[model samples]
Target: MTQLPPRFEISRQDIARVVAVFYERIRGHPGLGPVFAAHVDDWPSHEAKVTDFWANAILHERSYDGNPVEVHRRAGNVRPGMFDTWLALFDHVLAREVTPQQAQAWSALAHRIGRTVRAGVVDQAKGPGGVPILR
Candidate 1:
């Protein structure tokens, strides 16, 4: 019989570390800085929410139940090109902070979530009189 990979939970400290590292990058990153600056007003609250979101996504512990897609959509206009920049930033952070396996797993999940959010937002944007859905 085939064996499954070990099930592990990401700790709160890990989530905080990841989000802090990621936000540090966002602060300096040319592509994402302005977007984040413009949309994110409460840095502390935003950081906490992001930490919870990543924890839930990676650990499947349901630490967060917020809709990221809806949040992103409602926050402001996200240019189509921003997704590429976001992915690149995530890859950089993953390389710096996580194990190879952890990085790979996180990247895969990020891609899936990005794709889903993009499709949903794009679809809503195209619908007549429909508001873009944010997380």
Candidate 2:
């Protein structure tokens, strides 16, 4: 029997490989490295979880069960400005790890998610009841 194609025209193994390389670079990145190292103790475990996350997102596997919004919001270190840096690095990883079409599709998805997570982080910093802080 022929296997069903993965979502967004990307393969599951490619996602896992990209995630691994992305995090490997993250661990050594000047800004992102310290941020992640502060929270992540086990690199292998984190990579696996993130791999599952990508699988769920791009493969529709439903294996990931974590809330990125809450996690980034509660981290206190996650900043809206940081998403730009994160997306840039991630885009670079995608370009190197996968085909151009796959990179384009997945990078678009990553940017969308980054915007969402960034909004969540910013919203959590509101003065009260989701209201923006004023001077």
Candidate 3:
């Protein structure tokens, strides 16, 4: 019989820590930094918002109230394919910050949210001909 890994409760502090580290990486990333800088005017506030989002998501805390899809759609410089880079960086950060199971769970949630946001951005970018420009 195969043994399963022990389940550990993830806390808000853990989420905050991960968010802090992840954004630090993002701030230094050549591909993602410029894109983020164009949209985010305040790094501290943005980090807090992201930490709240993840804490609410992972812990079911109901702390985040903003619509992420709308936010992403409003980011004109955010390309559809940027989610891939974002997720890759997120996964890399998670691997160093959390257990494998935790990382997998968080990564899955991130991917799902990323797809939803990307779809919204794509849909909003449709031309009058109803064709997406694939940006």
Candidate 4:
């Protein structure tokens, strides 16, 4: 049986642009910048890998090969809360880079992926349940 194609159309170039712009913003973000800086020594290589990741997720291409959850969990510095900040910035980039339909679809996929990553990272850490996230 033939597999159905992705619901929305997005190109490798589009993914590359989004990844590039998003990372540029990330490097400047106070909360996220430091976190990413601690891990990523090379921005262009990181962006290319991330572009491959999105292409695999959205375009069904076989460019990316790795587990994001495992990477985040291993990072140790990646907090569960960081996914929110990451997604927010990513969505902002999507809004400016892609068509609205593509952005919505990509954002939905991203949130789903983000939640998985968050769950994986959160499982490795513990906090007092009664304590609030923000004081």
Candidate 2 regions exceeding 4 Å error are 1-5, 127-135
Candidate lDDT (C-alpha), each: 0.76, 0.85, 0.84, 0.87
Better of 3 and 4 by TM-score: 4
Ten contiguous residues minimizing lDDT sum, candidate 4:
126-135
Scored by lDDT, model 4 comes in at: 0.87
* lDDT of candidate model 3 versus the reference: 0.84
Best-first order by TM-score: 4, 2, 3, 1
Per-residue CA lDDT of candidate 3, range 1-135, in tens?
554332336887888899889989999999999999888888889988998887777766666889998888888888777888999999999999998989988888898988899888888887778988565
lDDT of 4 at 20: 91
Candidate 4 lDDT by residue in tens digits, 1-135: 665576589878988999999999999999999999999999999999998898888877778999998998899788877888899999999999999999999999999999888887877776687443321
Clashing pairs in 4: none
Per-residue error for 117 in candidate 2, Å, reads: 0.5
Sort every candidate by lDDT, greatest first: 4, 2, 3, 1
Candidate 1, 44-76: lDDT as tens digits? 888888888877666655668788778777866
TM, every model: 0.80, 0.88, 0.87, 0.90
How much is 119 displaced in model 4, in angstroms? 0.3
The lDDT leader among the candidates is: 4
Candidate 2, 10-118: lDDT as tens digits: 6777778998999999988998999999899998899889999989888878789999999987887876778888999999999999989889989988988888888
Superposition error at 112 for model 4 (Å) = 0.4
